[model samples]
Structures are given as structure tokens and as C-alpha cells.
Target: MKRTDIDANVLIAAFQGEGEVCQRALRVLDDPDRKFVVSDYLRLEVLPKPTFHKKREEIEFMQAVFERAEHLDTSPTLTGRAYYGLEI
Candidate 1:
């Protein structure tokens, strides 16, 4: 079985349910052969519980993923954004 780390954008896209993106996310997530994994850092980023009042459905979906998916190592902190060979 192949395992892959799921990014925040994929989860966000699925939650938002934007046309092609949502379809793609669902397809990958529904597949049984591929195993999807997330880190503690990513769990925090995409599944924040404090501000889901307006997106109850999204929160529920995200929670399901968080509960079902395999968790890896802790997420790394973003040191800085680099551009033009400089940290910005």
C-alpha cells in the first residue's frame, strides 16, 4: 500500500466543494489502495475547531478525516517565507 501526506489545500478544497477540485479530492480520498496521512501540524492547520461555526459541514468532514487518517510526525513550524533568495 502506498501512503501519501495530504496537504491542507486538498482538504480545504474538498470542504469548500469547488467543482473540479472537490471532485479530485473526493476521488483520491475515496480510493482504498492509497493511504492518506496527516501530521499534527497539518491537523491543526486544516481542522481548527475554534472557528467552524460558519462551516459546520466542513468542520464535520475535516473531523472525520482527522479521525480516520493515519497521523505522522509533528508538523514543522514555518521559519519564514523566502523570496528572491531572501527570507521575507
Candidate 2:
């Protein structure tokens, strides 16, 4: 894949060991050639709840992942389009 759009469910499953899908997603994430993309909405969505007690760790993990991949900040225009099921 040229680039992959990561969603909150994928991240949640990967972290929580909910299923094999998450494990597979993590493997794909480990690929050096693959580009991971996430919007600001995804950042908010993937972030663990404050009461989870692992907020710092989760944030660190997300930071490290983004540091290795391309980051696309969500703008108002893009957000609006995305809401209507359009690709950014």
C-alpha cells in the first residue's frame, strides 16, 4: 500500500489485544516502507480515556508512531469533506 489511514478501532484493538486484526494491523505498521496517516480527529479518537491510567504511555506510543510516519493535520475544509465521506 502507498499509504494507510489508521482508525481508532485499529489502535484500540492493537493496544487492548482484542483480536487478531489488531495484531495484523500492528505488523503492517511495523513495515518501513508503509506510510501511516492519521488526522487530528483520529488523534482524538485513538487517545485512551484519562481514567485508563495509561494515558501517558498511550500518548508516547502514538507520538513515536507518528514520528516515523507522515502526519496530516486536519483542517476545517478537510474535516467537512471527510464528514461527507470524501477522501482528503
The predictions' CA RMSDs to the true structure, in order, are 7.6, 6.7
**Pairs with steric clashes in candidate 1:** none
Q: Candidate 1 vs. truth: CA RMSD?
A: 7.6
Tens digit of per-residue lDDT, candidate 2, span 1-88: 5798877776666666546777886887777777888766875565536224556766777666667767786688865654553221
| Candidate 1 local distance difference test against the native | 0.69
**Ten residues in sequence with the least summed lDDT for candidate 1:** 79-88
Q: List the residue pairs that clash in candidate 2.
A: none
Cα lDDT of all candidates, in order?
0.69, 0.66
- In model 1, where do residues sit more than 4 Å from their true spots? 49-54, 75-88
- For 1-88, candidate 1 gives per-residue lDDT tens digits of 7797888888887778678989998888778887888766675676544244456677678778877788876524441221123211
Judging by lDDT against the true structure, name the best candidate.
1
How many clashes does the backbone of model 1 have?
Answer: 0
